[model samples]
Target: MDGQLMAFTGVAAGMVAMPGADFAVVVRNALDTRKAGVATAFGVAGGLLVHTALAVAGLAAVLVAVPVVFETVQLLGGAYLLYLGAGALIAVARHRSAATAPSAGARGEVPGPRPTVRLGTAQYLRQGFFTNALNPKAPVLFLSLLPQFVPAGQPALPRTLLLATIVVGMAAVWFPAVALLVDRLGVWLRRPRVSRALEATTGVLLTALGGVLLAELVLT
Candidate 1:
């Protein structure tokens, strides 16, 4: 393995490990079910592949140079994040209210489990894909950051694909691990209070991140 490739791998790993939208999406879905979590990870991998393809084809660089395009994407991304966060927060509120409100119960009648709106695999996949794909940061990062690691005197296209693929490979491994790890904690997470807390926190994190992203784009 080339020394430069090793360094790139390290940096790419760090980037993938960062707690961004992808991380949020994985954790959010993982809380629901392991299948949801794994599907989300796969979707995130798909999103990364899209970015790599764009970077390899020089579309990433082109988008970077075109500020309007990047800005538009960022706005949409921010809006989407805000929507996700808002939805989660709303769910939390509804859950809390439902918990607190007293309903007439028959004497000695057992209560059934509250109905949950389980999102299908396709929905989870799309959620995960959009969470990562909308950011526009990938193209920018690939354009600026990937080149620094590409070895000189090598075919740039192939080298770019190789490095980009490494990032994708890392993402593929890391996110599913994250999903599974969170799934392991399902025992405690199954508790309503704990679940609601997790939901609320993630909701705020996503909302704030989206607001900040949008604010930055608008203010700058």
Candidate 2:
């Protein structure tokens, strides 16, 4: 691999792998339904494709020109993280309430909405796609960060495509493994206590990530 390519790949992979809204959403879906997780993973990958194409096509340059654009994206990304975190916290609260419900405990009925066949794979996929796609930071990151790694004279299109492929490939490897692991874990992952803790942790992480992004934006 070209040195630049290697560096770029490392950066892209690191960025994608960082636990954020995207990672949280996918893992949540996987734990919720293994099949749906697979679809969600693919959908997130599709959003990456769009970002990669935008970067390679030079559309990102438009974003680079206005400092405000990057700042705006950062703010939006921060807000998104906050929103996701709040949702996770809500799930945790619901889980706790359900677990303690007197009648439910006595009757052995879970207090939450049971997952049904209605929560199909397509819905998860669509959720994943929209969640990642709607987040402004994703495309902005590709636009702002990716070009920095491209060599001065190289055909950016090929380089950009290569970078995107490698990053997405890494995600393909990591998330399905997560899905399979969750599948194998079976009922353990579905336990109310387990779900509540997971959601709570994810919520905290998202909030922290958002705070960091917001600070970075303010400083920049």
Write model 1 residue lDDT over 1-220, tens digit each, in one string: 9899988889999999999778988998898899999999989999998898888888887788888998998999899999999998998888777665556242443333332568999999999898889877788888788789877888898898898889999999999999999989988875778888888888999999899889999997
* Deviating ranges (above 4 Å) for candidate 2: 67-79, 105-118, 148-153, 207-220
Alpha-carbon deviation at 50 in model 1, angstroms? 1.2
Candidate 1 lDDT at 214 equals 97
lDDT of the candidates, in the order given: 0.86, 0.72
lDDT of 1 at 105: 40
* RMSD after CA superposition, every candidate: 2.2, 3.6
Best by TM-score: 1
Indicate the residue-level lDDT of 126 in model 1: 92
Clashing pairs in 2: none
Which of the numbered candidates is closest to the native, going by highest lDDT? 1
Query: Residues 1-220, candidate 2, lDDT per residue (tens digit)?
Result: 7788788777766777776677777777776778877787877777677777777787667766778876776687677677767877777776677668798789987565323233677777776665566566666677777667778998877777777778778777766676677667858876766767776887888778778788888787
How well does candidate 1 match the true structure in TM-score terms? 0.93
Model 1, backbone clash pairs (residues 3+ apart or across chains), number: 0
